[model samples]
Target: MNNQSKQPISPTAHGHRLVVETLNTHPNALRRLHSPGSAENELSELIVHTALHLDTVQKELVDRCTWAAQDLTRVATGTAAPNSLGVLQNSGLQIDLLAARRADAKAHLRSALAAYQRVTTIAKPQHAGPHPPLPSRTSPRTR
Candidate 1:
């Protein structure tokens, strides 16, 4: 047997796996395809979840920033109330905070994306040749 040394899993991934193992008491697709509780399958699910969560956070921040920007534009164009100085100030601050949050979310998303790519690479190992030999059918890429 080839005794391959495995790399250490990230803390985030490990914690996520713990939750999965605890909750995955039933026979799900992951269990059916990758045994009762495969660590790789659990990690894959965590990576996907983290990436999607970041996507959601980024979208929310963008929506909030857009609203704040619209408010500022209205104030600038004198369309808003004359006594809306407080609203203008609050809108600017709100935009700044939203931008900062979006930046942080982007950083986290990049990390999660990298982790996901690494896991995918490991799961589907690099093929020696450009195209792998098929059983009998021609490769779709060649068609």
Candidate 2:
């Protein structure tokens, strides 16, 4: 008889794992998305958009962490008194979790920005100089 019971997975935990995995794999995945044609440009554009979106998400995570920390501070200082020890402890635990999440989000955001920069560099023209004039197609006799 199997005595081990399966533990339920939280949706938030699963989503976080997915996000981490995606970020870890993104560079290779982005490379794979590039091809010999217009797809490279499209992929670079997509990466830029994704990086911008991640920046927004990171900002929100920072805000959440700040709020949670401030709330925890208030509770600790008795500025916002809790009804019981249990409430205070729970609030502290929640704040700790928020801080952890904020750290993870920041790391992910940095990775995304790096990827965006790499892709944009790849998309840029190889020659930095001004465009050369077109060679004259007409011969002396034709001119």
User: Residue 52 deviation, candidate 1, in Å?
Assistant: 3.0
Stretches of candidate 2 exceeding 4 Å from the true structure: 1-82, 128-143
lDDT by residue (tens digit), candidate 1, 72-142: 68868999854444765776787678667656755664565456446646878666856765566664554
What's the lDDT for residue 72 in model 1?
64
Which digits, one per residue and each the tens of the lDDT, describe model 2 over residues 34-122?
56456454654454444444444545556666776787789789898755657646656765676576566656555654665576577
Q: Which candidate has the top score in lDDT? A: 2
Alpha-carbon TM-score of each model against the true structure? 0.48, 0.40
The TM-score of predicted model 1 comes to 0.48
C-alpha positional error of residue 13 in candidate 1 after TM-score superposition, expressed in Å = 23
Residue-level error in angstroms, candidate 1, position 38: 2.9
Instruction: Give lDDT: candidate 1, residue 90.
Output: 75
Q: Which candidate number would show the highest TM-score if scored against the true structure?
A: 1
